[model samples]
Target chain A: MSSSSSADSRRQFLRQFGLTAAATAVAGPTVALATSPSTMQYDDQKKLGFAIVGLGKFAQQQMMPAFKECKHARITALVSGSPDKARKLAREYGVEEKNIYSYDNFDSIKDNPAVDVVYIVLPPGLHAEYTIRAAKAGKHVLCEKPMANSVADCQKMIEACEKAGKKLMIAYRAQFEPFNLDAIARIKKGELGKLRQITADHGRSVKPTEEPAEAWRVQKKLAGGGSLMDIGIYSLNATRYLTGEEPVEVTAQEFSDKSDPRFKEVEDTIHFTLRFPSGVLASCTSSYSIQEVKRFRAFGDKAWLDLDPATDYYEHHMTIGDKDGKRQPKIKEGNQFAAELDHMAECVLQNKTPKTPGEEGLKDIRLVMAIYEAARTGKRVKV
Target chain B: MSSSSSADSRRQFLRQFGLTAAATAVAGPTVALATSPSTMQYDDQKKLGFAIVGLGKFAQQQMMPAFKECKHARITALVSGSPDKARKLAREYGVEEKNIYSYDNFDSIKDNPAVDVVYIVLPPGLHAEYTIRAAKAGKHVLCEKPMANSVADCQKMIEACEKAGKKLMIAYRAQFEPFNLDAIARIKKGELGKLRQITADHGRSVKPTEEPAEAWRVQKKLAGGGSLMDIGIYSLNATRYLTGEEPVEVTAQEFSDKSDPRFKEVEDTIHFTLRFPSGVLASCTSSYSIQEVKRFRAFGDKAWLDLDPATDYYEHHMTIGDKDGKRQPKIKEGNQFAAELDHMAECVLQNKTPKTPGEEGLKDIRLVMAIYEAARTGKRVKV
Candidate 1:
């Protein structure tokens, strides 16, 4: 639809919903329709086209189903290393045959106007390469987290997207989840007063009991460090987000046993402290042998925000507490993945930025690097 | 009231309340009635007389009122440098004229059987001298917090008390407070699962505002340091009590301003990390110029225990969050001071060891000394 017609339809939709539409038009035709969908010409909702780049277990089981339920976005293309799985998923999702692309033929999708955004669900090692390549192919990128395995990789991905003039948003779904967002809002609004300290931990028993001799996760070159880079990055990111300050220094300790075959390549558990500029310190831990899911807390003078099972894979809850009274009310039953998908779509259509931007991902990667350095040197590391 | 009659009355009170009287009966004759009183048993209270060694502001304000409400305890003697104020307070509290003792005549309280316990509320530098003398005098002791300024002093005080066979308990009131005790109980019960991280921060805006330096709180010899020894020691004690673990190592950073006259003799802020044997790491900070107060968080696999404004001077709140699919429930409107006082009374009357024993205080003092050493040497110090 034309920009004027789309704007008119959005206005009509807003009016029907008893909401006011912005008078001025935004940059794109999609922006106008996204802003006001009340009195437009088109009756059908315009869906932003998304493409899945990796047909891994997570994509097959979680992301694919989440996309099906998304109102603003739809899966239109598939790119995978496995041709059989790619063909099956593409057919199941009703994508056109021409929209299917292999790893080697991913660049051809640049000219296939149907795909507007590419969600990079590849392994940790390949995230930087695919993100850069996708950006060069003129597609907005939603890269899965740890952003890239290293700070340099994150910076490169961000620069590549900047050069290509495409949005590069890291998929830190926690930033978009309702409970966590509420926590962020409460913290930013000074509901917790001056944040004095933060504590975050994420762990789970991911030990391979009777699996293969060596998985990609157990490989240092592919996954970086074991728990710190894999799951501990969440603790680091969430702490920074809640405190709203970059850490000045870090002191960390790692536990790894070569005798345990699972920990042959990387550390099994890691603990670190981040000293912020505001004098707020964060104590964080991540472990792969522990059966704990997620936890986070931000404490201040007047109140505090705590999330128990904070980064739960599926559901999460957040609570705020006042100094004199009990904990503030909580927002429960939040789906991080669904919330993130919707946010990404909003960022694309509305010309906004994702909450977990490339810079944020880079900062976490830097802290992670420093933690690893500190653990190795047996000394505090400045970031 | 005779011991036998007191015991009978205690049993009657316990039976009326449907409680076990056997617990109090085992405590012995002197404690029989005090252990389980039906009302504020003023007649049977016996009035164990107390001698305030240092008539400081805290002693005059906090301890005097506490003693007034204490059924079995009374401020019968005063030892102070300010004879005029001591005489005035002694008359007001209805102490016998002969019970009023000056600093030079403090030894007289040793011979006077009227004074049973000597409360050392003196400066940190003076704690060693008075506590030793009080121990020599064979008086039970309840020294104010930081037990003594140094680890050596803490050790000496404990030894003196042990040698004299008189109880020495530090005023680490958090152990007795209901909210803190509840948090400890929840943590010990494994309600939050395996304890992973402990975070605590205690700070206040204690900066002087052009007033003449009147209080001993700003003096290094008196208060030890700005915030760490004054309020931050509570965090240290709370972490140990809540985790039930001793930290193996500590790394610290201290900030002081030679330019600011107020901080010339002490640190303005300090940040430290404690690594426990169970791999639970604690990040703690204390500041004198910060606009924040006490907080503590104990995180575990299944849930967390959070106390924001944890060290509420008047009121406190405890929140327990479980991974049961919703927000954690909170216990509110808790009075920490009254609970702490009652617990101390119970310990004395029932002959029970306090949760915050002299040993706990000594451990915290050792940790504090290690933190100071680390800050000075710019290296991690083993505790």
Candidate 2:
């Protein structure tokens, strides 16, 4: 490779793995010296090798491009349930044919030192198992959200990474998006004054489609719930982050289309309230049978900070103001997916925990569980 | 008075009340006839006379000035628990000495035709009694809020007015404030999309005082609770008006400094959530031991609207925007108090129901009651 491309590769590798200068100086030469016939060889400053495990639509469209442009990381391996699609993606991305793996041979990847990190972009139910297997293969993992279907599953995933001495990060993209970050920073800085309330909502209209025998998302054993686990988690996370206070109590109500067979085992809509220790109250809602909208607002004694389409799962805007005035059109430009990946890489390389760490995800899941329990029991649940 | 003075007076009166051409035709002749006692027989339309009761701080500052400038309304009478203050205020506001009345003589005013409206600016505990008395006296009534200390009191006030065939309006200034009205209009028009969440907060620091010889505001029996019943009512009303929906269920928590002598019988702070039938959720907070701030925000799919320092009890701003962009500083001009009084006068003169009528007050009081009950019972309360 040209010197410029070589430097770019090193930067990309460092960015992806969050490798600090000290860590790199120690492990860089060692990794280079250990290369053998089957091992991938790289200079101390070369890019870190990464692969996406699920060759699904989201992975093909969004995740692939993200890796391609990452300064410290590169798409060096491809894995998929479909061998044909994996080979196709490898060819299109200029990844080597030998670097491709299928579900059956995923274990063999342990010997492929070419790939250092695995991005698990599978369906919800598959995340825990794939992540744990990737950890056993000595690869750091970036898993798609809801962390896992249950608290036990999430704990298992975390423990697997711990045992492997590898980083495991949950993809909560909104936490890294600038607008949301700015809002959190402003709240921390007391821009809104003493925060007294937070309101968050995530809603969308997603009609049920007839799957060819089995679609993981429509199965309760896979996706957890239709809307709450899918989109409502955003509301829950955003509320906690913006308030900067742990919820002490929760009360929730849920409604489902019992007449609609598509709602079989999941809720179509859910509403919940969280009371924080600071006396701030948060009201949140998530719905799948509604027009799309995502928002977060924090109100204080002097002012307020608000994000419309706050958890857009992508780009959004932020506003800060008080009774006397407001500042808006505060542009938030960039892809949250890229931002989140970048943050995860930095956390891993720098030996720092992510802002939305495993514990945060676990806490959110706990709140979601509490909401479900409250809905079922018709009683307030202590968080 | 000279015809020129009479004409100038009429013009000033029209300007003060914000009367339109239609209102002028209805109220001008009667006011002119009433003021020109020597030259013209008293015409009811010209004699939109009003009495100021309870010459306390708020009445002395806000109501007195408002009455002075009201074109269709004149300060024809005065009533006070303190006779000396009543006589002095009557003199200062140009009321005839004979028109002055004390608490003992208030019933005698029923026989007098000069006063048409009784503006009860009393402490919360006295509102119901005075409002009921005014209704019995064949006078329209504008009662200062918390409407009353209890739901039973509010019902009594409403029944008294209904039985006497007079208009009864609550003094919820925020309902008439232009920016707030604009927010309600925008939300009603679906300018921000479909209402999904509303967050509101109102707070002010409690001033230290030593000579606490039973200040009615700090007394539980008189003020009901602390911040929730006092300032928090504004947040409740604003949330309902902005969403145009009554809350179906509520959950709340309250805090009190048990060790502080001041909080002996009332809450120091409160937080609550309201769930409306449209699946919209409202989170609100009120505190008396914090820096002052008031705000409200409504989020929808397409856009969002916010008012910071929303009910500043003075001035505020409104902002509107969507995920893609925003148009802020939308309606940040004008005095909220002036706007509210203007709207109230227009409502009365135009035979329009006040935006915050007795019913609106009742609903807010009901919600407050539910919140208090929920906090006490540690359970969600249906409204």
Candidate 3:
């Protein structure tokens, strides 16, 4: 086989057997070592360093705390518009003062060897710009979900990363959550029979806060569309990974309370249905006018699996059942963001494509755009 | 107030407090008595007797067993295409030999004093014919859901019953299911804040059985559409009642495995999005190619409510909580089918229109047709 095909085969073998670098490195004697990265084989325990952009509530509260749990990843750099907040967090996280950079000097990170990956936790509008810059800086990129505001921007981010020969991963933390990962593995194993339908919903009530970090979410230019780009991407991405298929057509409806000032520039809620190529269907809902709900239920011919609160950073639980009765699947709870960070670090260290690659991110953004278009036109949009 | 207005006020009051005859007759002075039906006020304990048309598996297995738990309803007669089966069931239920009639002599039920109502449990194509016949024979009608095969047929069933001065109810048992009832009450009380979105899904894997009752479901002329008419109606009706508003527009997608002989004449799956008058959106799915899953989740500004296995006969459960954590609501389980039967009986005895009146049934049928049209043409259909 050609060198590329040989590498692809090894990647497939590892993925199929549910072997991560941590597991394979420990089971070296029994497992084939040809696919194992040289660093892992030699017991090189170097952690891939991440430079988190935008020291917002999500970064400080979720991502920063998650880094403490990550085995193969650590925060080595911090980029923020707020110098005081960035400097303070850097000191607390044990990062050097020279590693902190503002948005204006973000490109200067090319000379910073410590920052091996640029993790963009910025607003949707800034994702493409920072991701491309990170790729150009010879660092891998781990951008947050929704990829970018538009399909063209997502494509640009993907192309820039590819051109620079740098890995690009989208931080779809749900994909790394225990329950969601378990569901995917079981579905692939045909535990639920042939997959037929997926119903996913993710939303939370968004109240206006005094914090500047929350302000950009309600802005159309910064957030892309509305709750859809902010929270609905969870449902959209979950359905794709669960079905393991691309949706061929989409029909959507947008909703917003005209009297509500918060919805003046964005939709409060949007519901959409996706029709996959294999005649499978997925119905999803995303909203900003509701309390938190993250649920994913996949139904197959023989059985069904449900994960209520599916996308939580921790405490994700699941039930595997059919028409007869429900059986609780033993779930191991962990920080999803941490798992995601570790996975990205492994991909970078091993010179392997990310499990959630830029292409996967691009597919979802394209679908998000199609969903918005369908809702606006009141017609089905092919993706 | 005028007599009609006074009657409306009384109906509204009883409905608001969820004072079914079974509850009010037992609660006595603790609950308001002014709204109590006069028939119940006079110490009347007479249970309305029903002549169930179409002695099929559903009627035999579910509705028949449910009658034992009903407070104000009983099976006084049985009408069937098979004389032997009807006579056998009538004998077991302690009905007189003369009370049993084959389809050929179904109109003879008019003369039978035991038959206060005709519950049509036939195939969709037969529902209209039998409902009209029973209405002409001066019996109140409680037809099973989907109302009929066509919108015109649903209208005909309504007019015939109206002309006969008998109550007409469509057996939307999910509305009477305890958990569903609790959700409606909570939403109406603003306990969950302003309702913003509803997501409902109902479906089950339908494999063709040797029984003739299962055969008609796959036949287009008999069952109308496929999954939408049979099971999708639950999601559609739940959305309507939950929002207390009609959907202004609907967009839907259809799916069917053509290789499966069962779907030769109908779609196996359908996903639809309903846009309500107040901008609330409901995304729904109905399928015949999956294991049992009936779930309804309502999201409001303050909180959310979920009913998993929402429309089941016995095992319905619920949880009411928001983003913080789940708070289990004390769900009172009851036989939904029995509750539905009692409601129809009470409506007849009290000279009141059923909550799921013929008009309500007609509205659902219209939307069902709209959904099918949208799915077929791949365009938004106005309801």
Candidate 4:
């Protein structure tokens, strides 16, 4: 709302839009403009030894494989209830047999020198416990997002990390992806014009499964919430990272088919709209009853940025457009998992704050809670 | 909500989805399924004549030229305040100058037997007056969408046409577009599985202008509403057409920079989310402060149909996707304006009700009012 800053922004907008003085000379002046990543080190010693927690599908399929490409991070230990699977992965990753520990013995990892950081890749309900335990065990923590089930839990995890003087980074891999990074950089340059509106939709059909292990995501106690906690968090986090603005208010509506056992404990779909202090509006949807549609699109006054399949483990296609038309800028491909993994390692080495630290994750949890509140009460909830 | 009807739907869903008995037996019986365009004939008659009631940009640029491709409608009269421009267009399009009429004498078209239908292509604020007058003139009426300024006005227009016994069609051109029709058919055939969610976003940049004629759209009285009435209607109407259901409720939010003179009289952006009776959720956005982006995408439990630039006047690209992948099905190109024009002509010739009749338009206006009310009151408004 400052006049001088807006004048600077208007001048920047004019330059980016190819507007000349002659055009502005005849036309009048307009509205006042609304006010609108990381490093690491690994110099001294061996690569940071990360203990893989909860060796689930994401761990075995994405994280462990991604560690092979990481310059400053490597999986040196494993923790899982399935000892046979853990031992196989430990051998595959060249971890000592003693380094493999089950959850019952996980706290004893404090005495082990191999684990420099504990990466918590558990269900939403277990994230806080594991993160806080790992912090108490004197290791830095890299946890998956939706940080935890509740804001209080997330705060406890952050406090545990802070009290122990250890870094707590939420592994928001999208923030580190090269394509998303390019979009963030371009928006900061005023290349996409002043951001006006944003849309984020991420969904996939989820049906009831026979296996209890496979159905934990649909369980309220395990996943914490429903589609919004799992897939919907991507849409919520994208709005924040894309605009770099916290929403002032949220209005949300949810649909849960109670007769469907898959949705009896969790929601099927959650659609929410956000109002930002800068006057940018965002409409987002996260659904468990629909096919996969990962979309993050933002429209500025002059141009727009769109990321189709905006988030996944590996690669995302991004395109930005203007009056001349759309173009997919070629960005050097980088693994999001690897980028985020290495970032945590570097942050620990340099004693620097992680870009998506516990506090950042906590902000999203606050918004998610507000969204659910709005949906439940049928009213707009302030964040 | 009926059990027998739901059984029929489940059977249809299973057959269309290629689901086998084996898959259903293991998954178990689940939630009851959520209870989830057009024609014309013109024979033994000369082509119906259309009198274009506005010589505005849309009329001059898109509609007049599309008449060349129309099979059952042709330009026979002109109505405009500017005589020179109207006469020039009339002559160019092979219309006699005697058929030219201004607003003052527009009602006298009743004596001209050549003008069989009046195509109301004027601004949104003028639709009711012209549609009613055209109906009183004993001519069938084809009014452009966003029917009228208010629900009451739209009701009056519909009643006037019904009282005069003239066919009144709202020109929902997308309904007549072949690609959109293909999407509609595929959805009805269950090719897209059970419809679950809809997303529509349409926006473009607008700047302040000196000319009154050029700036009528940004004026509240002249245009009735801002971007919502002009471009946002595409997103709103698409949700209805794509799902073939009326929204039960609407929650909307608006953002307009009052300091910007262009938005002082009207909103700069309006975002709305709707809930349909069948549990399908829709999120829509319309803006005047951003670059052009037209998108309409629907996701079913099994498949998705997307129409990029869904409501543009001419050719639009469409893609439908399932588990196999996205495919752009080739649909024979059709001119939307001409299609709607000929549709009205055919309805009049056959004495059949038009697919997008006055009642349909009135329904949309009522929803639009609800949307505005929702935005202003910061509450969910039932449609």
Candidate 5:
């Protein structure tokens, strides 16, 4: 990091955190009684207040609801072009009116010491812009994935955060997903011996010609690429985490029906194969025009672990298989969004880097670009 | 076809078929009453007898047993290199000693009018030789899937049958499997709307270092090309039939661990994508080093049909899914082997082309060879 010393910046960050906690305590004699039941699950002094940028469906539906269950994170601010939506959500979350900031004045969030983190959940194209601005505002940044449109943009986002001495973490919820974490733990324990193959298929029937809000997902400027960028990254990222290795090479194939107006702006499907140094091959596919399928499997010489509907927002199922037979194993489930939020907050308070930081997000985008190159050139590409 | 007059040859083929049935009728006036219960289930006179060539486990377990349930076919002869094994099965099935022939004396089966069709169930490498020899013996041929090891060989097998005025059929039981047929029927009737993509994953945990009899499956001389020729063909063939169109191009990738003894002679994993003329793409994969998986799905605009453990010897399941939700559909199942045996016999008796004819098998082999080329070259190859 370009900071004279990251420890010094982190100390400064915690000083502001300490001051906010002291102020909250001084303002309320019975702070424990005033807080919501969910807040009582964990120490509120260790928690970080986050300002969520972009009140999109994903932000409103998945993130806001998950905040109520977070042990180390709380919604302190809301940034949106729509003031009414932001005001209503702020009132519901007991967020002060002073913490509400529109995109036009998002820069002024720097004065609000209550928000120790700015979570950028905007479209991919705007990720770099908002992340850089957020870093300049001296708050740690938690950005949504497919970090940016290009490797250059991803690098710039990372460097911008480093220059400002603020930590930047890409919000990859899968890293905190319990079922996926269990699969990785099982692989490490040799439950599936000598992992030889990994297969992941994730897709949904998405009509790109729908409302502009949904159609932006297929626009090159907004989405950067099609299924491989939007949905396929899940499998790509999963393969990496499953093997804990980088792919040496990749070959990809993609198609989109031109006659279908939904595919006029972007490809609807992509299939790619990755070769890791251990000789473990991963075959992955993602489609916007196909049936919904969220499944992945890690195959080995002795047995295999399969997860059907693996990466859904909730309720993931797992099956273990061998020559004898297949059996479903019980799993302790948790909200992925809440889990990631707690993890990110923990990293901030402990002065540690997040598991899925900007560099990890950059690597995923690099592989996605390579997949596009291979698919376009009709040949294998070195990763 | 080399035949100067196909109609004349078909008539001649039916004349020989009629002669065999008439001879059987004349030999015994109480034929219907004297035959086994299985044979009495159908018209004894209308049934064409099949010479079971190569009494391997596949023939003995799947075919020899299915004949009892066939309404238009009956087992009349047994051919094998192992005399004791062939003789034992011959006795069990009530085959005359004269009808049983060794590989060395296989050509002499021509003198036995009771053997109207020679079912070649040998390894892929030997399919062409046996098919041509059977055609030369002037009998209709029901060869196993993967007509031969190469496209050139597949062509020769087809031509040999044509020149000898005998019909040749490839035994692709998937076409006759009840659940699969229902899926096709649903697609044909537009139950799933416009078919956009197809996916198939078929594999089994195979240790090629095991017994020689089972190890021959990984030998190029016997199995042709490891998993693709041995098992991957199921997904390849399924995609072709489900699309009802030939793939215009194919891209393939394969992997095997050099440290694993099971993959010493051939690759254990392969993934390929096929692009059809209608812009539909099919992603398929097969592996010898993974856990057992037999599944395929046809994704459409409205819904998708998934079959778990599809194309297995028995107990196929089907699930229908739409944007509304997923539902399991009850499918009236039938034994694939029995269904195919009946279909092949009906084709021979009616002088009609078999649903999975030698030409169909030739097309599949052509694509399989193309897949190998793509996998080796790491480039897309036109079919």
Candidate 6:
């Protein structure tokens, strides 16, 4: 695809998200790779420089590799507790030694003009702290999902970013993926007729049965809830976007077998139903003890569409069924993480609101808390 | 298929249902068409005779035609409020003039020994009335789904049948359909691992918007509770039989736009969530204003299975997914109504309990009432 066609596609894609003119203008201009003023020869000053905090597995595997495909974003610095591992990845990715910093001296990043954006990819308990600190340090923040451990923390982070006049975006990468964007476009166009219901699920077995629950994700204080805070948010967010409606009430149930070692500290599964104000209902489930299963199916009065592995990085695909017949529409595929990163970069440079700001993240957190309440009380709780 | 192979398959199928020895013996022995002692040459005394009440669209199109494939069942009588229509279908299906009766003279069926089973295919309000009259006539009863208009009526029908020393079965044909049976067999065999959740929906558009509400189904007094009574029962019953567990609580919501004439007296849509005692949860939806959408998906710890158009007569198909990959097993296809009719016939012939008895239908009726209460009050209702 040429740059002009890419720009057109991005325009069409961002339109479904209701992006503003400033965001659209950022997509039209091309930024040439410019070296930093300091000895960091690999740093591109024209592109938004991202300081990646927490060099964990997901950051190293998905986000680091995705920077190669981003047009307006580049990783300029790394902040990690392990200096040796951070130095090894910096050498492989061509980052200068001066740009690399350990957690002990993370506050010194404010002095580095090379880092324009701070991407926090730490555990749930640390998200609000780092986001507020980054905003105070005069840098845009791209925080990973679930915002924080509680709704109060999310609000604090949002207020901090607003006080600092810095852009704050949540890493809801599915909102930027091509397949989900196409689905939203079709629904908005009324291609599937009046929306009625949405059903989605995301599940995967993380490790072997014999594995111990030593990971931060299995710790309740660090991860917040269980699978709901991790993967269930995808289905919940998908329902909101597909129907363009917020749920009015929620009822839920949690399941965990004591015999399963992985669920010693957390729940293994959760099933919930969301009743929308328009009378549309969504059935959602999330599990950490099941084989890979990711799907989103939207039903309307005239037709239906299904997306199996709906939120995957590469294998996401869709099938639309109507009176004519079922057919798989050609959906453009690209790096899932790069689009969100570029969007955040554009939002910062243009001084515009991010598509998925702190408010959107807080909305999901409120629903999650309601779901937990419903499950605990066995009643339908209003959202 | 050879006759012996067919017999073997029938034996295997009936075994899953736990048929009595006499029923199995009847399957083993091939019986030639035997004439009745009277002048009705087409009537076979060896087969159970069914007196079909209410010659409506469903009985005329599906149930009557299915008798041709049933080796143990044959249509021997017709009872209708419209005598002309009764005479018409009776002639076409080879029923003697003396065997046909009007609803006014329905009690006279006791004089005809050829009428062994009374199949009631009327509106929900009339099911209990006809079932009780048929039971009093010393005939087994096979009633269409939603068993009756209320739980009290269902209980009364069961009591009347038990007093008459006759079997009473609900026409939950999906339980006997080959595809659904295969799916159930696999689930029982642990092919999908430990069951965790079930999601299902049944929705369809019936007629144009301008059509008048002339049918009895649109009246609350006759049809009970609209889509939930008409179609939602499929998904509800499926969750029960598939999991072999009854739901302990339910939460539900009903939707209908007043502008739509069809829903002026009834709900056009309903969504409900079921929580089983075993911690298994099922989310189900039904609608009367959507295009055909029938599906049932069961999720488990190690794998999952999906059945699109799960409750259809001929189009139902299933796909299983596991660690190895996804695969579609070739499920046997046959006349959907034949198995249920044959089972009822064998149950009467062998003096055995019907697989789907009146008590089973009453159990579902109790849950249906609970669901309505939950939807009305917006609170979880214990079953």
- Poorest 10 consecutive residues by lDDT, candidate 2 chain B: B28-37
RMSD (CA, Å), each prediction: 13.7, 11.1, 13.9, 19.5, 10.4, 11.7
Per-residue alpha-carbon lDDT of candidate 3 for residues A31-118, written as tens digits (9 for 90 to 100)? 1112211121112237878899877778888988888888899888887545556657777787776777755566778888988999
lDDT of each: 0.69, 0.70, 0.79, 0.80, 0.79, 0.79
lDDT of 1 by residue, B230-325 (tens): 877878877788889888888777665557577767776677778788767676777665555688877675776778767765556566665453
**Chain A (candidate 6) TM-score to true chain A:** 0.87
Evaluated against the true structure, the overall lDDT of model 4 is 0.80
Candidate 4 TM-score restricted to chain A: 0.87
TM-score of 3: 0.86
Please report, as a residue range, the 10-residue window in candidate 3 chain A with the lowest summed lDDT: A28-37
Model 1 captures what fraction of native contacts? 0.09
- TM-score, each model? 0.72, 0.74, 0.86, 0.88, 0.88, 0.86
lDDT of 2 at A135: 92
Cα RMSD of predicted structure 3: 13.9
Q: List model 5 lDDT by residue over B199-289, tens digit each.
A: 8988887754354345656666666778888889999988987888889999988887767777777778998899999877888988987
Task: At residue A106, give the lDDT of candidate 1.
Answer: 72
Chain A TM-score for each of the predictions: 0.83, 0.84, 0.86, 0.87, 0.87, 0.87
How would you encode candidate 2's per-residue C-alpha lDDT over B1-383 as one tens digit per residue? 11123233322322322222122212211111122112222243564677777676667777677654444666778775454555567667777666666555566678778787788876576677778878988988888778887889899999999899788888887776678878888878878776766767777655425433225556675667788888989888887888787889887767666676667877877777787888776777777655556877777756667687688655576777654555676564554445445455566667787766787778878888899998888788987
Clashing pairs in 5: none
TM-score of 2: 0.74
Candidate 3 colliding pairs: B205-B290
True contacts kept of each: 0.09, 0.16, 0.96, 0.72, 0.82, 0.41
DockQ values per model: 0.11, 0.15, 0.62, 0.52, 0.58, 0.38
TM-score (chain A only) of candidate 1: 0.83
Q: Name model 5 segments beyond 4 Å from true.
A: A1-45, A208-210, B1-45, B259-261
Task: Give the CA lDDT, 0 to 100, for residue A178 in model 5.
Answer: 92
Judge the docking of candidate 4 as incorrect, acceptable, medium or high: medium
